[model samples]
Target: MFAEADWVVKLVMIGLIVASIVSWTVFVAKTLELRKATLLANQVRQDADALRSLAEAGDKPALAGSAMVQGANAELLLSADALHDPEGVKERVASRFDRHEAQVARTMTRGVNVLATIGATAPFVGLFGTVWGIMNSFIGIAEKQTTNLAVVAPGIAEALLATALGLVAAIPAVVIYNHFARQIAAHRAVVADTAAALLRVVSRDLSRGTIAAARG
Candidate 1:
């Protein structure tokens, strides 16, 4: 059926097929990336809570395997006077966590725009092909001087095929784009919550350090 299409129609079909393929590919990649990011966010939140509990119990064990904890630890180690101003220390620690959270959000949402583009523009492209096919059909009718059904049927069929192909490519792309949008928004919320948990731990530690310094 595609081979019988006019050259312009053929190109349109090919473009729609490629767009569909790209949309599905992005869907798979984004799904995996979001899953990983969500898991990491959960792990970081749990580790931060554990660290906070340990601090309250007077046992500050080094936390490993969590980016938020590792970043806070690095900052604390680098600045001996970090606790001199508790607010300043909290700001710096929160900044570090925010950076990591932003990075995770970006990673989870990469390639999602491609799906949006395919969904929004594919149907229009297919419509163009249909219009072109019908125009050619009308031209053939004028040149051949015939209103015969046999002569017109093939052209109309080819024109309608373009519209069908367009819908076929567009429907899935739109559905997938919406799905990822929801998932990404939820993942970002999780990351924000995890960042908040880490910030609480940093604030508590800074407060303790400031009190001890004042007594010294």
Candidate 2:
């Protein structure tokens, strides 16, 4: 059917096939990225939660990709002059966590817009191809002056092929985009929890009145 499709229809089918491939590629990459980030979040959250104080946690070496411990320790060193006020330090630390979390969310969602575009536009693009093909078929019927089923059927079948290809591309992209939305949301929550756990340790350290701070 595709082999007999009009040039315009063929182009649409090719583009949709490419779009579907791209969407799946993004799905695989984003899934792996989010999984790794969540794993690191969990690891750091557990480590931060076990800390007796930020000071004790500070003595430990930084985990390679985990940001909570490193960023928290950096904030402490930056605001060491104001460590006398736990409220002030906590406020700054909290703000830092918010910014970091936002950045992580942005990174995780990098390729998601491609999926959104494919989902929204693929059907319409395919419709255009089908419409063009049908118009040509009608023109051919006028020239040939025949209403025979065998003559009419091939054109219609080939035109509808474009719509089928469009749906093939669009449906899975919509599904993947939705799945990623939920996964990314859950990953973000895990990050927030990790930050909160570290913040609690910082509070404990500040309450202890330890003027000594660790540098990242």
Candidate 3:
């Protein structure tokens, strides 16, 4: 079928195929990343002891990928600064947690835009090829001066093939893009909830002056 396709149609099919491949690649990668992030957020929420252990270790880079851990660690650092007012420390730590939550959401959503672009444009690109192919088919008919089935069938079949390929590439892209969008949103909500838990821990430690003593 590809061998029979016009050069322009062939290029369109190839481009759409490539786009479909890239969209699937992005979907798989993002799915894995979001799963890991969600797991990390859950761990932080479920195990206060482990969260404190991470902060006490002062190994900021060890679990840098976990937004909850990052926020907890930042709160520890802020609490350790003796010169800063207690109220000011809480504000700074809260700000840092917000930043980490935003970063986690952004990281989890990376590469998803490519899927969106492919889903939106692949059909139109295929339509362009179909139109081009049909135009050429009509030209062939005029030149051969025949309305014979053998002469018209092959050309019409080739033109329809572009539309088929276009839908093949587009439908999955659209479905996957929407699925990832919803998944990412849910993951972000989890991250935000974990950050809120960390903030509560920070508040309790500040009230007891435990954070400063731990720093000492």
Candidate 4:
């Protein structure tokens, strides 16, 4: 059917094929990316939970480059100049976590929008190909002045093939796009939990410092 398809229909089929390729490519890449990041995030969160205080989170070689670690470290430095006030420190750390979470979400969401675009537009693009194929077929039939089933079948079949390709390209794109959305949301939640855990560490460290100052 594709072999005999009109030039316009062929172009539509090629475009749909490219869209399908792009959608699957994104799926594979994101699956790997999300899997790796989630594992790292979870590990970092667990390590942060086991710490006695932010001081115990020192160096963080194992947790290096993690959003939780970076946010906590940056805020700890900035908060130190505030006279180790726990309330001020925790508030600032929380703000940094918010930005870090947003940044992580934006990073994870990269390239996912193409899936949505393919899913939403593929079917309509196929419909256009189908319409064009059928219109061309009708024009030929009119010129030939023939109503034979054999004469009518091929054109109709070719036109419908465009719609089929469209659906083929569209359905999985929609499904994968939704799957990525859920994955990203789950990762975001993990990040929030990590932030909260580090916040507790920050508070614990400040409390100990305050107590030591009182004794001194």
Candidate 2, residues 21-73: lDDT per residue as tens digits?
99999988988888887887777777767777765664555443456666777
Per-residue alpha-carbon lDDT of model 1 for 128-182, expressed as tens digits?
9889888878887998999787777777788888888888888999999899889
Q: Between which residue pairs do clashes occur in model 4?
A: none
Give residue 136's error in model 3 in angstroms. 0.8
Report how far off residue 95 is in candidate 1 (Å): 1.5
Poorly placed runs, candidate 3 (over 4 Å): 48-72, 75-84
lDDT of 4 by residue, 1-216 (tens): 889888999999999999999999999999999999999888888887787756555557556567666667766665556744678777887888899899999999999999999999999999999999889788878988987777777788989999999999999999999999999999999888888888887677677775234223
Ranking by TM-score: 2, 4, 1, 3
Count of backbone clashes, every candidate in sequence:
0, 0, 0, 0
TM-score of 1: 0.87
List the global CA lDDT of all models.
Answer: 0.75, 0.82, 0.74, 0.84
TM-score per prediction, in order, is: 0.87, 0.92, 0.85, 0.91
Native-to-model Cα distance after best TM-score fit, residue 54 in candidate 3, in Å? 9.1
* Pairs of colliding residues, candidate 3: none
- The TM-score that candidate 4 achieves is 0.91
Question: How high a TM-score does candidate 3 get?
Answer: 0.85
Best lDDT among the predictions, by candidate number: 4
